[model samples]
Target: MSTAHDDLDNEHTILPSWERNAYAWTHSVRDGHIESRRMVTDGAIIDVILDGEPRFVLDLGCGEGWLVRALAARRVRALGVDAVSDLVAQARAAGGDFRLASYEDIIAGRLSLRADTVACNFALLGKDSVERLMPAVASLLEAGGRFVIQTVHPLVAGGDHPYSDGWRQENWTGFGAAFPSPAPWYFRTLASWVALFTRSGWHLCEMREPLHPGTGRPASVIFVLRRR
Candidate 1:
């Protein structure tokens, strides 16, 4: 799911990105919109791998590969890939072995490289799109490898569904982000996400939704999956 950046969806997707569109790539992935990813990509993601002690990791939709660089610092064998050119150049310059390709291409068996673990932090993948990308992600891993993905919670991402109105009243929150016109996100519930993961051939081994520290409720859904 290419957020607002990808030109695929004309409708306002619940996946609101920082920039207006994927074509607008001058700013960083963190620069445009949605502060959620900053937290998701920073320590939370690294913790998943670091704690698990994954020997090899692949950063899906790696963007500029900041995460990959961080993974490298842990001495983990990590690789990253993205669909953008300049970002790929930047990632390489940063000493990350970043590739210029989409997960779809690699998943379709178009690429030769593979990894032991695949990580996707705050990447948006549509229902069908994830199906296509999953096998490729799984393929990169050795047997019993891990696949970790994070995205907008479905409850928050509900803004993506086709609506009769321009933007539905129920589709927004103060922090919610939309697609197309920058409406809000299409948030999925915990059940919705679990279903997607099981359908994608992953079995949920653990789940975490970090809170705002004082609210005592989940702030976001984080899942650690293992290939079944």
Candidate 2:
């Protein structure tokens, strides 16, 4: 059982953990070891983004730039941004348009780019960054643009734990032992997610639950939102 202090402390550990595991993450993703992403979330996010027919996209927290490359191949101009230096290097080496920028950098108005679509694929991890980043994302959208987010389904991820908002530890199960420090993620209830979007000057346009092909349970949830 985790106390409030532990949750608070865990929130601050996410980035460092990612920093330590960046290489392992890149390898796992490129090798197609993340089963949920390979079998479901990847296609789900792609379909949602392309559905809007956006010519330009900005992928937030784009690890290894796979989403950017995927969109680029489909004729959509995309730029990938991430905080991890090694991941950015790997992405650039792979011919991806990646910029190394932290979430705080983006929230501080450092990025001067706009796009018809902004996508965050399972990257909104921290509570503070997410609360501040949501409103900032609105400022980076072109006219009539959309923002798409794919994340762990609150209900599905809740499991035996209480369905509330707080930090949860990630052991990196099935991701192999090379991940030395698995990041702790903050979980938000379904209602909490909607409230956050509403307060952030955005409205949910659509919500999708992508089911795992084998288990037939929601593997993740996608939120398609537009600025209010």
Candidate 3:
């Protein structure tokens, strides 16, 4: 039986608005002081990857490849893939290994790169993207490999915004002119996130809500999953 979520998944399409401000977004997080990243996301994701001790990591939707550079510094083999050419170019300029490929291409069986761990940081924004990428993620990981995702905490993301399964425009309040055409992202509740992972044949292994250092509020949520 197809549920409402399934119906919505089939209807939604990928948004390319991120490409508009790719340069700005890349530069913003390059130094890693962008509130959320500095507060918790950076440490949380790196800790998970180090704990897994994987030979290689495939950073899906790796905008600008900051995480890839970080992992490479630790001598961990890491490759970043993103749809935006400008972002990939910047990553390469920063001495990071990055490929220009979209999630659509990956889901369609176009790219054939596998790794022991697949990490997506704050990139799973759309329901359609998630639905399409989940199966491809399974194919990209080795046996017993882990998939780590760090995204905005639903509770925090949905505080003022509606708490439903739909797309919402980014609050470009603090981003300044760097983020001109902010892209809208799909907001999924905690339960919805877990349900999507479960249906995609992933076992939820660990979950954490990293708090903001200054405000002490939940900044983002990290989920670690292993293929079942």
Candidate 4:
């Protein structure tokens, strides 16, 4: 739908230790509200999908493993994975079994197990990573399993300054998302976002644009994808 939103990959590491670095940035900016906000949003999504039942889950990019703990508390079989080792260890200690590896390495063979749901919440990597990750997400889901993702709203990513349009970005892996420059993010429009799901062989079943607490404008777009 969108020229693949594919055909590109990052040669650089982007941002090393994204788990810790992102948390640091969030804590700094959100002033201890990052975790709470993430929990509320993520829990809300997970709840509707499960419908008051215990669902087997894989928490992708599961930093600090908070969701894993939440799922486990609800008697759900929750497994967590992250690209950062330290985060994995901390996650494992918190509750569920956690692994430190990229999505490719895990899905390649090591953790080839499919689950009732695969979730990547509040962890929007650049385009290349998302492209790479989505395929694996599809593969790791049982028929009818859900693939839910919450990313930075593309509108929000493209900052709007009064005088200028802000630095426009056509790609997600650009300097901002991959660095600590406090740079603007590269968000996906609603149409483009749906196009990605279609191209990836998934269908969007649920959608929402919950407004930010302070800002009256939309804060985020949430999606629930099912294998086609």
Using lDDT, give the best candidate's number.
2
After aligning candidate 2 to the native by TM-score, how far in Å is the CA of 6 from where it should be?
4.7
TM-scores of the candidates in the order shown = 0.71, 0.95, 0.91, 0.75
Q: Which digits, one per residue and each the tens of the lDDT, describe model 3 over residues 1-228?
A: 335775464334334577788877876786543777776889889998889998999999998888999999899999999988888888899897889998888888888978999999988977667787887798888899999999989888886756777677675655434676756677888999999999889999999888887889888899999998
- Candidate 2 at 226: error in angstroms? 0.5
Highest TM-score: give the candidate number: 2
Q: What range of 10 consecutive residues in model 1 has the weakest lDDT sum?
A: 163-172
lDDT for each residue of candidate 4 in 1-228, tens digit (9 for 90 to 100)? 222323232212433535435544433323434433553456565665466253688888777787778788778898888876766666666567787767667547667788888888766555555655666677788877888787656556546632221222333232232334332223456776788788878889888766666666555667888888
Better of 1 and 3 by lDDT: 3
List runs of model 2 lying over 4 Å from the truth.
Answer: 1-8
In angstroms, give how far residue 210 of model 2 lies from its true place. 0.7
Write the candidate numbers in order of decreasing lDDT. Answer: 2, 3, 4, 1
Candidates in order: C-alpha RMSD to true structure: 6.1, 1.6, 3.1, 5.6
Two-way TM-score contest, 1 vs 4, winner: 4
State in Å the error of residue 147, model 4.
0.6
Q: Give the higher-lDDT candidate: 3 or 4.
A: 3
